[model samples]
Target: MTKDLLMWDETLFRDPEVFEIDYVPEQFNHRETQMRELAFQIRPGARGGRPLNTICRGLPGTGKTTSVRKLFAEIEAETKKLVPVYVNCEIDNTKFAVFAQIYRKLSGHLPPASGTSFKQVFDAIARILQKEEIVLLVTLDDANYLLYENEINRVLYALLRSHESYPGTRIGVIAIISDMNVDLSREVDPRVASVFRPTEIYFPPYSADEARHILTERVMSGLYPGVLSDAMLDLVVEQTMKSGDLRVGLDLLKRAALNAEKDARKKIEEDDICLAYQVSKYLHLSFTLRTLKDEEKVLLKTIADMSSEGKEMNAGEVYTHAKEVMKIGYTRFYEIVKKLDAMRLINLDYRQGRGRTRVITLRYEPQRVLDLLA
Candidate 1:
């Protein structure tokens, strides 16, 4: 190992060109079988075939998006049979926002965010597809968000039913939901749901050995050669499996690499791995808090207060409690709570088999969010 004050150019080492290295393979690993099956779904050009509705459910960074991208790339290269597009559902949470994203992406221009009429925006999208003579397979990544906003049905209706109005063009949906329980079929209108039965696949976290292989390959390929110890790779792989998040592994590698440079060291050791783990936790927890607005924080605290007082409630119930306790308007108060639910700072589950009056249950322990604010 080099001396702490060694003449290593930390910045140069800080940014190792990962892909240029030993082909960091996590983004593309153990996915061949899945990709092959996904191919036929998106390949609308096959005779006697129509558009396919497909769903991929997995933990964060389990390669849901990466796998789809890889499959689409193969489809694009080998066959011009279809047009493929992907959208991050988090970025398009609202009905209008989802429509706008599709419109702008297809039109090769950014849609007017608010001022333009909705009809004009959608019309432009329709015209573009017709003029280009393209059939699209739209992938919505992190699609559980659409359900939280109560916009999943509307979005599906627009994409699926569009063909009825414009027989010249076709739009097939490929929805990606992160959790196993996120239900797309339940959310779709029955008239529309019949047309939307998708091939669903689940992605499990890589095992310790598999994760180690994946992470080691990434470290060797992405970081300074010979920088990480065997122990460091093992620890990272193990922790990643525990977290069920490949992004956490990626974040650790990125942070540990930075810390090694900060210490003026050319090689990353086990201590750096420990530091990296702590830093990742700090950042993830901090990001969760940082994304919450001041009002959202206060409202969460209010929910925490109610939950602490032994009152179990749903969004509507919490909204009432928040109104009575804080004297905020019903509209503003409920809106903030919904945002909190969307952020995963709170969980909202409706009572099963219940009608329109069913409400949501908070998923996380209220104290956790409360402490973040305090």
Candidate 2:
């Protein structure tokens, strides 16, 4: 019976990888304008001139990373003069690690992990670019991580202002972030910040129609024909629209397909989609909450406790409660709460109307958040 249970069903997935977040479609819908603008910026490098730096800012799952990667593929295909090297700042968060990434991309080998000064790594990068006579188009994905870790200024100086030290080598930066209000003037040196006058390109979240279109495309490629019903697809699209995250839709699609496959069914039923939605929400919340620092977790605990009775909280109420649990000042508490809001863990509204004192709402269910913390 066990063997029969494992052996009996027809599969629905033609290529499961198509549902992955990193999958690059041949035709990227709703992002053509931004791609064209980025291509134009790097156009000068093909003629041996320095390209203007750019900042690609948008909410998460808005296709910023995918678009840059697709552009890199295009640049590599068409140009021999420009070399595109992409790095995720969350992993390569320091100046030394970032330079090591550039080095590996250019030379096909990593520099010794330690005992190599940053100056040595930078010099090696300078020598390689100068020798190859090739321009470097460096992309820092999740760039706000660097700023939060206080590593952005040194990295910026190394990339944007390196031409001063090397002479005749061109390096362009494409900094990607989810936050739109990241100001470099406050963190970086004035000289380096001046050189990095980035042309900002914003990627807005998808509307319901756009989300449905994207889901349709994914379903066609990822699952067998007629596996997912149009009504079921609409349900997934609606859920994603509420979240404003495309990944949520893709996750739902993948999970629902898996659920269908698990029950030896050829078609995805509505119940499968509903189960997938709940599972995906729980997984996302757990993953995010686990990444927060202890202090941030404590703040989340305070919010969860205060809102346990299903009451909406204001900034002052949380502030007063958090003070008793943690010995933090008001200003610092406000900053941390705003950071949580930026992370989409909570909703913070500052209104100028009467009787409104910075309303705060926990975006996730309070009990669910507490369970995850435990």
Off by over 4 Å in 1: 1-8, 11-27, 45-50, 76-81, 282-298, 301-344, 347-374
Scanning candidate 1 in windows of ten residues, the lowest lDDT window is 17-26
TM-score of every candidate relative to the true structure = 0.80, 0.80
Residue-level lDDT tens digits of model 2 in 61-125: 89899899998998899987899999987578788988999999998999997799999988999
What's the distance in Å from true for residue 337, model 2? 7.3
Q: Rate the local accuracy (lDDT) of all candidates.
A: 0.70, 0.85
Error of 1 at 60 (Å): 2.0
lDDT for position 274 in model 2: 90
Best by the lDDT measure? 2
Give a tens-digit lDDT track for model 1, residues 191-244.
778878889877776777777767776776677666777877778877777677
Candidate 2: where are CA atoms >4 Å away?
1-9, 181-189, 282-363, 366-374
| Cα error, candidate 1, residue 371 (Å) | 9.3
